[model samples]
Target: MSVDEVAALSLTEVAHKIAAKELSAVEVTEASLQRIERHNEALNCIANVNAEDALAQAQKADERLAKGGPVGPLHGVPLAHKDMYYRAGRVSACGSKIRADYVPDITSTALKKLDAAGALEVARLQMVEFATGPTGHNEMAGTPRNPWNTDHITGGSSSGSGSAVAGRMVYGALGSDTGGSIRIPAYCNGLVGMKATYGRVSRYGAMPLSFSLDHVGPLCRTVRDCAVFTQVIAGNDPDDPTTSREPVGDYLADIEGGVSGLRLGVPTNHFFDDVDDEVREAIQESISIYEKLGAEIVEVEVPGIKHGFALGEVLGRVEAATYHSTWLRERPEDYGTQTRNRLMQGFYYPGTRYIEALNLRGQLLSGFTDEVFSVADILIAPSVPMAVPTIADTDISANQGFLDMIARFGSCTRPFNFLGLPALGVPCGFTGNGLPTGYQIVGRSFDEATLFRAARAFERETGCTENAPVL
Candidate 1:
């Protein structure tokens, strides 16, 4: 295959080709690196590119394949991850000036799982400073330019993961979601990103944004790629006590299981409040495609969604503030302006309000799930409720409507985080403005299989998964 084709193959396709000996892992990794070298400077996605080490690892993978023993599922797949996931003896700058030079002594459990699966980590991707902001801006490192249109924002804080995967710099990436970190980027970049059911994937080594809300998952080109990668990274981990002990399902097994007869709920409230006409049309088009695939689309009311969003913001700020109190008190100058300003808001949230939010989580979740799930199998909503904004348009420093833009981007997304439900944002169509847009399919807690099944059905119907940026 041509280098371009090698670079553009989906994660599952690349893994299968390598295991079949049709392509060497070195060739694939080199192709990915070459693409990164050619395009990353323009995109500003990778914080630290590990070409020399990745090539060496790829060569070893080739050697292991030559021996003809059983190989792991992702034996030669190349990937990059958000900079927050730790690698012992290496600096996980986490897109923050404060931790820019801090290197951890222990590797993240998620990375260990990927290592055991034989996937090669090629780079550390940029992110929102301290994973605080919703847009891609981070003064500490640099904002990742959206490959679709360099001027547009690649939603954060998994900005680099979305930009890199969409730009074909890597086949897949590990993206953590607190609020809309993973799904927003997916929606903005026209990729598949899953915020697995909270605790479905361990958060052992990732930097915490909101301890109760953070979820670790994958961003990839297709639902199948997302499923394959999620399968590897998920499951119980001793290092993370919060991890669910529920056996991870066969994501690939029933993914092609048609969504026929499955009822997908369309929220009758909140989600469309400020959504652009083009975005709503595109999402409606996606739901129509699901109908053609034999799925029943039902309009349902999701009461208390607003409460979930408000509560999520309160909890997120309080938790992040708790984590950064010392830093905010000592090295306040280190955080980016927007990040620091955002974290500082938490200081004023009264202890009672924080506890009230926490105490109310169970009731809020029950209200959300009971109303939505009782009526439909999964809830579908626009991932970002508006047109994908330009980096200039959403720049917090000069932009007069900072809070408004942030709320628009995170509105439809943060509620799921509060409820601890899994949400997958899959690219469905492009907006009239030509920027990509997507919808989020959310599942009941630990019901990732159903989400994947629905996403795969939509993916197969539209074939929109094949679109790539011309960068």
Candidate 2:
């Protein structure tokens, strides 16, 4: 197959073909590498391309398969991930000057799991410096451009993951979400991105943005791709005690089961109050499709949703600030203006207020799930409420209204991170600006299977997964 042809296959498709011996792992890896080389210059999404190492790994995969031994499910699938995930003896820049050459002595458990599953890592994609910004504005490491519209933002922290996956440089990527990092990028790039329930995946060797709010998940070309990827990485980790002990569900087993009897809730408040007409129209159209698919649409008021966002803001910033306090005091100049200024505010927040914010999370989550889930199986809301903004328009790090822009971009996503619920961003349709926008299906904690099923149902009906940016 040609480079673009091979690179364009979905993660599941590529994996199946490789397992069937219809395609060689080396050929697949080379095709993906060629796409990265062709587009990385314009997209600025890749931090480091592991061409030689990936090829070597792919060759090994082919040899193993030829030997007719039992093979892992993801054998020979080529993937990339955000620069933040660590591999021992390798530089995990974390998209910052502070860690520009920082090499870790331990590999992230997430990477180790993927390695065991036989997936090859093709590259380290760029991200917001230290995963601070919501928009993909990294003055230190160059910002990634949205493949759909290069002038627009790819939505950040996982900016490069969005760009790389959507640009077809790689089939799937691992992205971390502190406050909508994964979902916003998924929304902006027209991909399926999941921020699984808090503690669903380990965070042992990944860069820390907010210890409490951070989540590890996958960004992929399709919902099933996200499902299989999530399965590989989900579960308890001895290295990270925070990982959940809950039995991981078979995400792909019932993904195509459809949403025939499901109740999908639409929030009547904060989620839609600021949404653009184009985005709102797209979401409504998606709801109509769900109704046709036999999903009963219910309008429900999310209890304390606004307060949840406020508390999350307090907790996330304070946690991030605490982590970077030493560097803020000593190597302040090494950080970008936005990241530095953002982290500085954490230090100023009163300890009592921080404690209160931490205390309120459980109360808020219980109240939210009790009220929201009683009426709906999963809540459907805009992943990003506004029409996608241009990079120049949102490049407000030095501007006075930087916080407002960040808040606007994260208005729909941050609250869930605080609530620690699983949310999936699936492409519904595009706004008038020619950029993609999507809705997130927020499920009960650790109920990622339901989220995947609903998302897959919509994906099948709308054929949304078939759409890709014409890079």
- Per-prediction TM-score to the true structure, in the order listed: 0.98, 0.99
Give lDDT tens digits, candidate 2, residues 1-471: 788889889999999999999999999999999999999999999999899999999999999999997788789999999999999999999999998999999999999999999999999999999999889999998789999989999999899999999999998999999999999999999999999999999999999989989999999999999999999999999999999899998998888899999999999989999988899999999999999999999999988999989989999989999899999989999999988998887888899998998888999999998999999999999989888899999876555588888888899999999999999999987888999989999999899999999988898888998987887
lDDT of 1 at 121: 96
Tens-digit lDDT string for candidate 1 (1-471):
887989878888889999989999999999999999999889999999898999999999999999986689889888999999999999998898888898999999899999999999999999989888779898878789999999998989899999999999999999899999999999999999999988899999988888989999889999999998899999999999999999998988899998999998998889988888898999888888888888888999888889989999999999999999999999988887888888888899999999999999999888888888898998899899888888887775724378777877899999999989999999988987788989999898889999999998888878879998998
Clashing pairs in 2: none
**Which portions of model 1 show Cα errors greater than 4 Å?**
398-400
Q: What lDDT score goes with residue 255 in model 1?
A: 91
